[model samples]
Target: MYNTLLLLLIIPTLTSGQPGKCDQTPPQATVLTPSENKGIYTMTIDMKSKNQNIYRPDQTYVLIVTSNDVKRPFKWFMITVEDPEVDNSSYEFDHRSVDVGSLKTLDTNRQSRYSERCYNSVENTDNTDKYRVEIHWVSPKQSDKKQRVRLRAMVAENSEVWYVGENLTIELGKDTTKPLDSPPFPPVDSCNLCSEARYEVIFKGHWSRMSHPRNYPIKPDNNGYSHLVGASHSYKYILWQEGDKASPGLKKLAEQRDISVIEREIINAMSVHNGTRTLIRGKRRDHPYMFEPSHSLFRVDRIHHLFSLVIAMKPSPDWFLGVTRFELCTELGWLESHELPLYPWDAGTMDGISYESATSSTQPVDTVDRVAVGSFDKESPFYQMNLNDLKPFGHLQVRRLDVYPLVGDDCVEGINEHEGSQEQEAGSENVEEVIEEPLIQAIKQDPSLQEDNCALSEWSEWSKCAPDTGYCGMGTQLRSRYRNDRKVYFETYQDQEDFQDGYKSQANMAANCRQKQDGALIESQNCFVDCL
Candidate 1:
């Protein structure tokens, strides 16, 4: 049996001198799911040179699964291709191996699934005690125009530990429309013809003192924020770094709410430096209090995986808050959803002791810093509060909307069809060797190891309104626990927000956290209540 080289990641949009988006060489590039670690392995093509990056439609190519961290070995994995325009499973694997005595599963009704690696036997396993393997893929013929495809792979260390591999992407078919200047990262940038993915940026305000408006500080009557300004760039560039003096663009943006300042910077980076690819902008919200949750949508590609954004506080002394350089991709690919705590920062451009302080103090500090105490007077707000004691002024939530072909223009933002989703079944497999079950004893383990024991860390605090999504959404309360010691579990509580769709969004995603049924302690998490 040939070692199945099962990777087919060509790449996503890239900046000049940056690694391929799907290529694992640059690190932290792709993932099937969002997580802290970018994983140690990724898929790659065994091409002789960079020119072979394009798939010439109908040609058979050899795919390989390689790792960056060779010290970390794995046992099982799942791989597939996603090309919305084509059948995902139609891109078949070259299964010419001769072996059996494996688990039998029903495939697409009567069709059996292809060979899945396990300790089937010494000779039949795809690879054991190894760091890499090779698989084959037969590319489909081009139809009318070229379309992009994503090769997603999932690597697991047993059932409980797995890293989502960075996606391997490549364009299918020949681009005959115009002779391209060059392939991005090699020749030039991929034309911004279509957006590869969509993410919803939810800005949740948490500035209220003691959770009550009647508290000490009065809410500003003219409170609101300017449009959110951000960029999607490679690992090499940063929109604003903490500790360093803010860039001319960022300095102007934070203190003056001038988005054009950063817009020019992003355009220059894309054209001259080749470090950034997309310039992201959102609409301005002008309303009283500004504590209510608001959201905006932006598009992204694989190469430009790191995100940096900044927004201004309308009434403070050059106070602002936003992520510096947040990573958006996981080992498997881009995240489905993510959230972060947001604290206020002092842009160091002006001096003031209160929200209504000097508008033009005109004293610039050496570097940017967080909001800190300038006076010990009790009348001065947040002066006594340590940087840690000062609760987050707001929070940021990112939820993926859609990816490629299906996502390009403005219409794709609020039109996500998450309901009625289903998975496709598999087809028949061709195994040449078969051994009776009685001959090969199945490896057994402790029953406690397999039971779905309730294992978890402490429950996280209930999220503020606009819990999981945009608009007045429900408050989310989540806790990370291992289901059968593997999957992350969550429980979101109520806070009176989005009445129409919030309940629907929660129904299919989380384990309900509620009181136990009378005389039935086991039924605590199984109950459902109407949010109406």
Candidate 2:
């Protein structure tokens, strides 16, 4: 019989917390009697009756269907298998697979009962074992109202599987049918299987005018040419309090880079709706003074959206680069990228005397400090630039692009809208496999094999003179030192024989530091705390 149904489907199917194979007997089925009128619901199953032998072929069958008192939930369910001696059947729901047609809808205000599972097998061809299994239920908001159903059937024969059917309960109340005074509405504690989601907000902008600091301005002047020429971003879902006050449309979009009075008065009065603006087109030495890299796109619905950005570091009077109220849905979910490192804030309303001073600063607004590189000194005009390669000047790639189906109404299709041409074809195939690696062709044929013989580390023992501050007075009692081993030799003839034997040779050390003892291990102790 198909090799006893492939040795009872290769046994080992014991779970309900194990232990079963007929010893704890329970494997039989025959539950008919189930029907409803107006709101449609039906059920039937036989599987050869005669004290329910369960059409053997080394049995294994399970069917669990549920629905209790419905009025607006129970969108669909179906399963049909009219015999000719069946051989296979499968159905599942929620965890997907109801023949993939419709099955993902169960939120009668967060589940009030909905279950499905069917598995039937009869092995090799049809041998007349009499079969029939049909089940269906649909509710267009309870078509004309009336529902109740519950069926549980499980069977597993020798080689194990058993829970044996018949717990069947059915009702289709239009006028009372009884048998369900409770049980079937325990499932509400946030079941958001992705209620609408879409992200994609790339905005990359790196500024440079020989990295800033030459007569600065490229426009907007009274004398001193302020030069950070372009930027404006906006987003809102409100929540910015810290002694609030700053409005006047955020000081005219931070000292005159005007964003239409903060998009009609503070992002349309704290937007939860109308508020969208993102314009970042850098470089301004006058007339689109060219300097590239700038992007923008934003959309977030719920998950407490909030974003704000502003840039302008022109001739200097009102300096800028402020980003407040970030929060792009956290709690481990919606934030794929967020990099901010543009510092220089001084919206104290305007003050200039350098960067070509167009002068203006009656001082007053306060909070000024954060524009460094020794804040332009070497005769000002922004000297030896390279503020850490312009400190990450704003990068915010949020990429989520579609995810809505936890009980669909059809809306969740838009996979990465060409995700920047699939990330520029995966960054040009990872820069052509990192320029054909072999460590970049051995550092382009020995560029001193990119030096790095690595060694430095041998201090250790000297840590007991705490009290640097648990103050009583003068304080300063420190003594600390560590490192008893550090090695690295990327073979190039063992780093040129450990750089010509400057170390590494106790069979190339590192066996507990080959009985320690190397050079440069200074440890000092100079403390003094007497005041009180």
Candidate 3:
């Protein structure tokens, strides 16, 4: 009996450290395939194999595992790179890969799947070695039951690689993306166009005095027209697929008023945005001719952030004004307001006089110039003009239109009143139409009105101050005066011969002496008395 008890004690000690059958189960691994799209590589892991779900909870517990035990299940899956040189800094897994939702498969026919995506980090290297993705599944019940699946990734053509402190580059075979060879432009995607924000673009045209004096005398009757003509505007996102080169569509818009070519090309092309052209206003003779404002709406897209615009100057031979590859949407969101001054550019496709010459040089399209040397020479009527001297010939403005509230009652009332007045003016026949004659003709008829001498009129003596009222402090002292005549005249010769013959005539000049007189009337002393 004593020997039997001793044997039972020995048996308990021998079995205490031994593993159970559940601990002996081995984990199975399935091979996974890797695929790529637009340079991003992905591999999916299925949680089930054969007839059994690998992620299922085992009833026979060597250790208790619950749904809350995320670290235990997550520890089973592992990813490793075969090539040590392959950079994996930018590798990321889809949300499903880490979310508990991925473990719940609704359809028994299909298993739960999780995926990982790999791409080059913002930093790029010259390493050309092939990279591998290894998925390891480790059994929690048994250390010897580990299984793994391996996959090789294929590098896609034209993959984008971002470098630290540098702009992004496209990987084209063995060639790395390089900076543009032309003049330096603002950084790409400086504007966040990939967001869900909406933007509004407003175009305003402000006319200024002719830049060059010789370009004047734009005789409207010479071309059977009345005044100088403006331009029709077209805008579009810059196209990178066409090697970022100027397309025939862009050339057509620059030389002509048609935007159909550009619209069609951009619509047919892949990964690009097309913009519409704005209508042109009629010709005008007055300086600061304000064109009716034009506006457009756009949803920012990823591949197209930089926008360009072209406006063909009418009554000219292939001359235009434009801004190339300008960014409207930025990291700070859509620009509140942006102003662009317009300038003239030679399209180089045709050669003719600046005014409605209707002559074509019939030359192939060439690089745009401000003014070609011999064609629009210094003496030419279309000579290049300085934009600064003209202040703002044309301006562009962009604003966020979605956030503002609608007009209130007072605003609506005012708008209705203004519209009513406009309608009355449009319908009335009593309103006389004034036709303006040419300034040269008026000048010739009044040659005596050529020059003006800045002459000041005499000032009258100050008036007596009024009796002080018993106000809080002291009443304001007052005085007033007027000149005998405010108008003045200067002498000018009629012609070169008249000037040589010392012949001169007087012309009336409108002077601002009245303003000076008013300023002089006010005393330097304080006008108001202190309040009690």
Global lDDT of each candidate: 0.46, 0.32, 0.31
lDDT of 1: 0.46
- Which stretches in model 3 have alpha-carbon errors above 4 Å? 1-185, 189-194, 207-213, 216-246, 270-290, 362-364, 372-379, 382-391, 402-532
C-alpha RMSD (angstroms) for model 2: 29.9
Task: After superposing candidate 1 on the true structure, give the runs of residues whose Cα lies further than 4 Å from its correct spot.
Answer: 1-196, 209-219, 271-273, 359-364, 373-379, 404-532
Candidate 3 per-residue lDDT over residues 336-406, each given as its tens digit: 44555655556666766654455665556455555332222434553332222333435554433322222
Please list the Cα RMSD from the true structure of every candidate, rounded to 1 decimal place. Answer: 31.5, 29.9, 31.0
Candidate 2 lDDT at 119 equals 27
Q: How much is the lDDT of residue 161 in candidate 2?
A: 21
Q: By the lDDT metric, which is better: model 2 or model 3?
A: 2
Can you write out model 1's per-residue Cα lDDT over 102-179, one digit (the tens) per residue?
221222212212322212211113435446655444444333455554455555544345555344333333424321
Better of 2 and 3 by TM-score: 3
> What are the per-residue Cα lDDT tens digits for candidate 2 across 1-532?
9999977765635323121111212222132222222222223433323333222211112233333324222222223222211213322111111111111222221311222122211111122211222222221111122322222222222122222223332222222221121111221212222343333333344444444435445553332212221111223333122234455544555566554444343222222223322212222222243233333333343322444555554445565554555555444444445444444555555555454466564456544333433222444443323233234433434344443332433344323322233434554344334321111000001122223333444443333333444433332322222223322221111110001111112122233233335443233555554555
**Ranking 1 against 2 by TM-score, winner:** 1
Lowest-scoring 10 consecutive residues by lDDT in candidate 1?
435-444
- Superposition TM-score, candidate 1 onto the true structure: 0.38
- Candidate 1 residue-wise lDDT at 364: 47
